[model samples]
Target: MTKLIGALDQGTTSTRFVIFDDTGAIVTFHQIEFEQHYPHPGWVEHDPFELLDSCRLCIEHAVNKLIKLGYQVSDIEGIGITNQRETTIAWDKKTGQPLYPAIVWSDVRTQNTVDQLSKKSPKGVDALRSICGLPLTTYFSAIKLRWLLDHVPAVAQAREHDRLVFSTVDSWLIFHLTGGLENDGVFVTDVTNASRTMLMDIHSLSWSNESIRFFGFEGIELPQIKSSSCIYGHIKQGALTGFAIAGCLGDQQAALVGQKCFETGTAKNTYGTGCFMLFNLGDAIPPVLSHNGLLTTVAYQLGKDQRPVYALEGSVAVGGSSINWLRDNMHLISDHHQLNELAASVEDTGGVYFVTAFGGLFAPYWKVDARGTICGLTQYTTRAHLARATLEAACYQSKAVLDAMNKDSGTPLRALNVDGGMSNSDLCMQIQANLLGDGVLVTRPKMRETTALGSAIAAGLALGVWKDLNDLDKVNKEGETVFRSQLSAESTERLYSGWQKAVTRSLDWAEPVDEKLE
Candidate 1:
């Protein structure tokens, strides 16, 4: 029987099941996009049941396709899961019913919750950073969990009854995949997912009593933290029943692994709905946290006995989503591919700068109040310029993050491994290369299904398909393209300076106002 590996890539907007051969080539896969609920201006949510159903459907569909391609279901070695981090879900442990909708990682409904927590800490928002390596922001899972406990009565009631189980999307999927209520599903999360919860101690790789006490989470059951490439459990019910649930990782960290960035100073920028750049820090825990606006997170832990690798991550709130906004909201283009064509039509942005701070700026500038702004717009600027500016917005933010990463590590990245939706655009990658200047190279792989391949790699390692990291050198290393900077340093700096000025205009644009008459 030909052995294969399966990966479940549960992302912010869609869920996909991919099967990969031994050489890291994609055999068969299925993807399903679910609804995204926007109840309020800044709130984003996903139905917990819908998320689970999507995963199940993706597996069934993909497995059927695999069979059509002359592969038995039993040929699959194991299944790995990679998910969007910090999207908190609470459920009744007894009945396997969700207490509330999953609060997505991008939701900002907890700004007031953030304020309340900051005031209680003597060091303000920076108090927990030393312990958890994350600031007290609305982005982390703990903040979202706190909001659910405070606002949702069902969650509080479950906690009171000692039936509450809280975890990220990975644990949620694992719980059900391994048999939810009937089979006593495994309740565990990996180090990568646990690190984003703001409840785990970064140095110790376990749940912190200090963080739990600070958050006042007394009665809930937290998932046991494990290594990224260890068997959590066996699937009790699925197309691939009896398969080992071997590996798990957050999506961004999975991309880091997929890009084969195992060495220190190696970095990758994933240009998805949002842009995330993670610089690998190897196996040692940092003595200090980021002074720049980057997050210190666990990159991966290959096995239970292996040491954890760390990373410095910088997040940009808007990337390819800006193109979506232009297509959906502004009606600038009917299709996303047109964005590249239109952008290529213009020589440049015509001195225009767009700050895409739609839901507030992330990384280096944790400004929750910052709104989107377009500077240097004039009557001379046309739709082509706006389209070019839209692409430039993401590249500029990435440059900002890369600059911060260089400053914090004191070691500049020589080349960036690029992937995700926006990286498909040759124009966008070229723009990114220009913005990054001559010192850096941007490389994109021909096989762009890297997120899925990453999870498969983890599962394959656990199953002994490959002996170690050294064996993965040629896994996804075919037909690679490298882009070098084409613009002069002086010109790049001038464009970046305009971006900085535009960002300044966007800051504090959404401050709350008291409506009461004096």
Candidate 2:
């Protein structure tokens, strides 16, 4: 019988399912986009049920396609999950229903609470950042968790009843897929996912006692901490029945693993709705650096006894999402893909620079109130110019992350492993190389769904279907497009300085700025 690997990719925008054959080629796949909830300005959320349904639909659709092609359902060996890292969900453990909407990673509802906590703490914000490699920012899950417990009535009720359970999306899915806490299976999260929660000790790779106490949570409410590559549980029933639930990691970590970046100094950048750059920093817990908002987090832990891997992450709140804003909010383009073509048409941005600060600046800035801005606009500014500027903005934002990683780690990066939708654009990859003044390695996946492939890598290892990362790396393809920088340091630095100035103006401008696209 042939072997197959299955993965559930639960992202901020949607869920995807994929089946990879023994050679690591994708046999069948499905995807579904789900609804997002924005209760107020600076807030982002999702209905847990809607999120789950999207996964269910994707799984059924993808598997059914393979079955029609004469693939046996029993060929699936293990299931792995990769999810949006910081979205928090509170639910009733017994009834298995969410008490409130899932608070998305991008939401800033807890900014005020974060402020109060920083003021009261002795070492202030710097102290916490030292401990977690994350600043006292509202983008993290801890502040969001605190806010929901305080403001949401149902959440408060369940907490009082000892029936409330909390998790980022990964834990929620595991509970439901494994028949919930009532059915004997319990809640747990992988080290990569747990590190982003802020409630976990980044050094120890466990839930922090001080953090839980600070959040005002008592005993028995927390979930177990598990390795990224281990058997989590089994799906008692679903389209994927009897399959061992083998692997789980946050979306970004999965991307890192999918690229097989096991060695330190290797990194991967995902240019999805947002751009997130992560570097494997080995297991050292370096002290937080000055002013940069970079997060020191768990890259992934293979097992309980294995030494945990660490990483530094830099995130840009809007990447491809800015292109969507151009289409949906400004009506500048008929199709979003026009961005790639339109950008390619322009030799340059023609003096224009777009600061895609839609949800504020993350990693190296940590400011929550920043707004988007398009600078150096003139009568010459056409759609092509703006499109070029948008692409440049994504590259520029990632460059800032690379700069921060250098500061935090003390060694400059030699090259970057790039993936995600934007990485497909050769022009964007060239711009990325020019700005970073380093080589950009673009791995065009045999499967475009690398997020799903990553999950399979993790899950397969845990189920003993795959032995180690070396086993996954054997199937991990090696073909890549390499963009080496030819630009002088003087030229690169000059352009980066201009990008910084444009971002300065974009900050805290909650209202619109007038600049006609002629």
Candidate 3:
């Protein structure tokens, strides 16, 4: 009987359950996408119940397939979870019902609330950034939690009755899957997820009292903070009952761990709906590290014994989402896979550059007023030219983040481990390689689902399925494809410089845009 690990990946757009053998190969896998709601401009949400149901279905389906393949349910040594971080949900502690829709990380409905709060703080809005390593922005759970407390009637009612339980998506799923309120469900979140809420002290690795007071969220029952890798609890009942539920990381951090970025300066870019570039900073939090626009966060905490590993992260608010807009909105590309072909049809963008500041630009800029802009459009520009420019937009944004990471860390990245949907496009990857300039290599794993595998690795380590980090080296040893810069430094600079000009034009395009904070 070969033991296996189950990884539950709760992402922004979908939920996936993947079963992995000890060697990190996928035994079986299943994924189900959930609804993404936009009630208003700059607002995004997910039905909490739908998120839970999707996980259940994925798990059941994956386990059934595993059984047909002759693997016993008991062969699952543990279950690991990686989730979209900072998607806030306030639920009834007793009934297990959400008070409001889960506020997604990308939702910027709280921009006005952020502005109001910033004015009240001493260092203006950035007062808390020093403590939380995040700017006062709508991208975190703290302000979203504050907004729900201030606005939602049901959430306020739940709070009055002492039934309000606050959680990120990871905690929400863990609580329900481990028996909800009936079996005294585990009320906890991993440090990686908690770190994104802007409510945790990175150094102490606990909920910050000052932040709680600042947000006026003193009474809600927040989840206990746990290390990224450890047995938080067991599955109370399910297809795989009594399986130890160990290992939990926020999705990007899971990618970092899955990519085996154990040493400082190792980095990876996850080009999902948005892009996140995490440069590992090891155990010590550097004193002089610049938090300017970039965020500092927990990369992972493998066990209680190991100190929490940290990373300097630069987030691009629009990555593959721009590609999504092209397919669904513009109707230019019929499918995502066809995008590469369209992009490759053109020699260049015909001097066009796209600044995909859909909601606003994150990382290194933090320009909340920026909106999408396409510059240098001319008579000769075709759909293929626009397609090439769109791919360039994603790559250029990543390059800006990479440059910032190098400046802050004082060490340049030699290579980047890349994953997610856009990494599948060879043309896009080549563009990324070209724009990133010389001496940097972009590598993609054969099994692109590294986020799920990272969680599985964490769970396996906890249950002794794998002895240590080194023991799992051969897990995903299938050959990898690597891309290096083909463009000269002078040409890369000229192109990226034009991208900067396009970005500047997009800024403040929607200033005084009414914020629906009330």
Candidate 4:
């Protein structure tokens, strides 16, 4: 019997299922995009049922194709999951029904709640950072979970009944797919996802009692923290029923593992709806280092025996999302793929800069007051210039994050493993390489579905598809596209300085006005 591993990649905007053979080659795949709801300004949400249904549809669709390709259902040994982190979900323990829409990672609706908690903290806003290695920001899961429990009626009822189960996307999917609450469902989250919640201790790799108490989640039952690469349970239903549900990791960490950044000092930047640049920090808890306000998070843990890997993450709230805004809101381009062409049509942004803080700035600048801004624009500017500026926005943000990572780790990154939607644009990759300057190479894997592949690798490890990390290196040895710096150091530094000025202009532009008087 041939062996294969399945990877379910549940993301912010879409759900994807991919199947990989023993050699790590993608055999087949399917993707389905779901609706993203913005009920209020700065708020984002997704239907939990929609997310779960899409995964099932993708799995059924993809596996049928795999079967048609001569692989039998019995040939598949396990499944792994990689998902968007910090998206909070709460459901009933007995009924397995979601109480509220999944609060997306980028949603800032809980900013007021975050502020209240921060003000009440004895050590101020930085108090949580000491224990969780995360600042008091809306980016973490804890604030969103609190908002749901306090505001949502069903969630409140579940809490009152002591029947609430709070989980990230991975856990919710796992619980439902593995028999739900009725038959010993696996209500667990991997360490990588748990580390992003701000309710888990970074040093101990477990739920922090202080955080749970501080957040007032005493009655809520959180998922058990598990290693990224272990069998959580078996799929009880669906086309791929009876398969072991093995590996699980937050998307960015899965990208890190997929990029094979097994050693410290290695890094990867994922250009998804939001951008994340994760610098692998190995197992060292490096004193809550905050370079430009970068977040410290768990990278992954393969198994129970191995120590968890840590990472310094620089998050940009907008990446491909900015491009979406251009297409959907601004109507500047009819299609997303047209961005590369439109951008390449121009020599530069014509001194224009776009500060894409559509949902406020994250990482290094945690400037919640900032809003999206376009500066240095004049009659001379065209959509082409705007397109170029849009792509440059991502590159500039990446440069800023990279600078912070280098400063914090004291180890300069020599290369970057790039993935996600925007990475497909050669123009964007070239601009990224140019901005970062010499000695920095931007690499894209031949198998661009690396996030799913990373999860598949983890699942494969448990089933003995591959013995260890050493075996993975030989799995997909395809050639990668390398982008080298083409700009002079002087020019790169000057352009980067302009970006700094643009970022400064965007800050403090949209502070929330208080209407209620104390």
Candidate 2, overall lDDT? Answer: 0.80
Could you give the candidate ranking by lDDT, starting with the highest?
A: 1, 4, 3, 2
Q: State the lDDT of candidate 1 residue by residue for 461-504, as single tens digits.
A: 99998899999988889999999999999999998998999999
Candidate number of the best lDDT: 1
Off by over 4 Å in 3: 285-288, 511-518
Candidate 2 per-residue lDDT, tens place, 1-518, comes to: 66898999999887889888766788888989888776677678899989877877888898899899998888888788999989988888768888888999987667777777788678776546655666677777877777887778888889888888878889888877886656766488888888887778877777788777766777537678899888888876668866778889899988888877788888888888899888888875553444566877888887667788888889988888788789988998877678889998988898899988777888777766687888999999998999999999999989988888888777677768777778888888888988887444444554446677778888877766777667765675755567877688898999999999988887876543111111
Model 4 per-residue lDDT tens digits across residues 1-518:
55789999999889999998877789999999999998777888999999999999999999999989987888889999999899998889878888888999998877777778988878776878878889888888998888887777789898889999888999999988998777777889999999999899988989999999999999789989999999999999888888998899999999998889999899999998888999988887653457468988889999889888889999999999999898989898998778888899988999999999988998888988889999999999999999999999999999999999999999999999999999999999999999999989999987788899889988988788888998887776677899999999999999999999999999887656331212
Predicted structure 1, TM vs. truth: 0.97
For all candidates in order, the CA lDDT equals: 0.90, 0.80, 0.89, 0.89
Model 4 C-alpha lDDT versus the unseen true structure? 0.89
TM-scores for the candidates = 0.97, 0.94, 0.97, 0.97
Alpha-carbon runs more than 4 Å astray in model 2:
285-291, 438-448, 510-518
Residue 458, candidate 3: alpha-carbon lDDT: 89
